[model samples]
Target: MATKRLMKEYNSIQKALSDTQEYENIVSLEPTGDLFSWCGVIRGPSNSPFQAGTWKIKIEVPQNYPIAPPKMKFVNKLCHPNVNFQTGEICLDILQNQWTPAWTLLTTMSAILLLLQDPEPTSPLNIDISNLLKSGDIKAYNGLIRFYTHKYAIDSV
Candidate 1:
């Protein structure tokens, strides 16, 4: 029997899948184990250094779900402050201790999208990249981000 929490998370995922916007660039989801765990994809935003790139990510819903945000990691190569290059582990506030029960999958996805736009250098998973991002050298930063985008992100169809 499914617990009420799992059912709510399932519903939230369903709603997010249905209402997702095109520009959001999230590809799809597939079950990895039970109803709570899934593998997903999100395309990099356009007009940024990551434009024309697609990155695969994994989403693991916790047993507590909404009360504790889902864990997400990139399955593809990535170079960013909030994302670990080796493990693809992400560092995001909402996904950690600050998570709130009212947050939905859509909101989580939006946060991921925004992270791609502005990575948090203060709390960084990739220290080198974080330092570069903090240096105020826009050209170098764009170049580095673009290089990683080409190495990891895929072209959209």
Candidate 2:
């Protein structure tokens, strides 16, 4: 059952990427070895500090997927309030306590893109970045993000 659902989700993701411009930032999302493990790349959203950056991620889908959320994490470094600088762990509700069967991989990736655009400072993995946001230091926050984007995430091809 889980394999069937994952194949469906994976197929739909590939089809959308090929047939439409909607998920343009999602560079790729393909299986690593089998249906349960995958890798993906997402170009950061435009008009944001993370612009031009390429972020890679790993996805480990549980056997009961759709019923239980997949475990995902950045494979590249990202300096953001909701992401751990050293570990690349993400702090997001949908990936955790708020997940539901209704949320598909496409929607989850969309939510991650939204999170990049608008971070939630209240709960954070990088306290320094979150503090900068909370303290209304937009310049410093944007600067740090840009620095990290350059240092950790640009893909030329």
Candidate 3:
């Protein structure tokens, strides 16, 4: 049952990515050896500071997933308040304590996409970046983010 559910979810994700006309940002989603693990690339949202960056992400689905949230982390470096600069740990409630079985991989991915655009400063993983964001230095904060994005997330092709 667990494998079946995981496969179903994986298929749905692949289907959604394949239908690129309807979706944006997400560039590719490929299973890494198994249905439970995947690697994806997302082009930064066009309207954001992250624009032109192609970020890589790693997703690991637990055997008891749905009941427990899947582990999602950025594979490339990101300078965001809500993300751990070194570990890439995300500070999102839904991926942690607020997770519910009703949420699917697609929903989680969507949340991550939204997060890139709107990070929550109050519940931040990187205090320094959060301080920069809240210190009324929008230009400086965005500059750092854009710099890191270009340094680590630029697509090879």
Candidate number achieving the greatest lDDT relative to the actual structure: 2
Off by over 4 Å in 3: 20-22
Error of 3 at 13 (Å): 2.1
Q: Given candidate 3, what's the lDDT at residue 38? A: 78
lDDT of 1 by residue, 34-113 (tens): 86777777777877888878887778887766667788888888778898899999888888887888776656766887
lDDT of 3 by residue, 84-135 (tens): 9998888889999999999977777778888989999988998987999888
The residue-by-residue lDDT of candidate 2 on 1-157, one tens digit each, is 8999988988898899888888888888888999899888889888999999999888889999989998889989998899999887999998998999999877787788889999999999999999999999999999999999998898732
TM-score of each: 0.84, 0.96, 0.92
Please give the lDDT score for candidate 1. Answer: 0.76
Q: What are the RMSD figures for all models against the true structure?
A: 2.7, 1.3, 1.7
Positional deviation of residue 27's Cα in model 2 after best superposition, in angstroms: 0.8
Worst lDDT run of 10 residues, candidate 2, spans 148-157
lDDT for residue 86 in candidate 2, whole number 0-100: 89
Candidate 3 colliding pairs, count: 0
When sorted by lDDT, best at the front, the candidate numbers are: 2, 3, 1
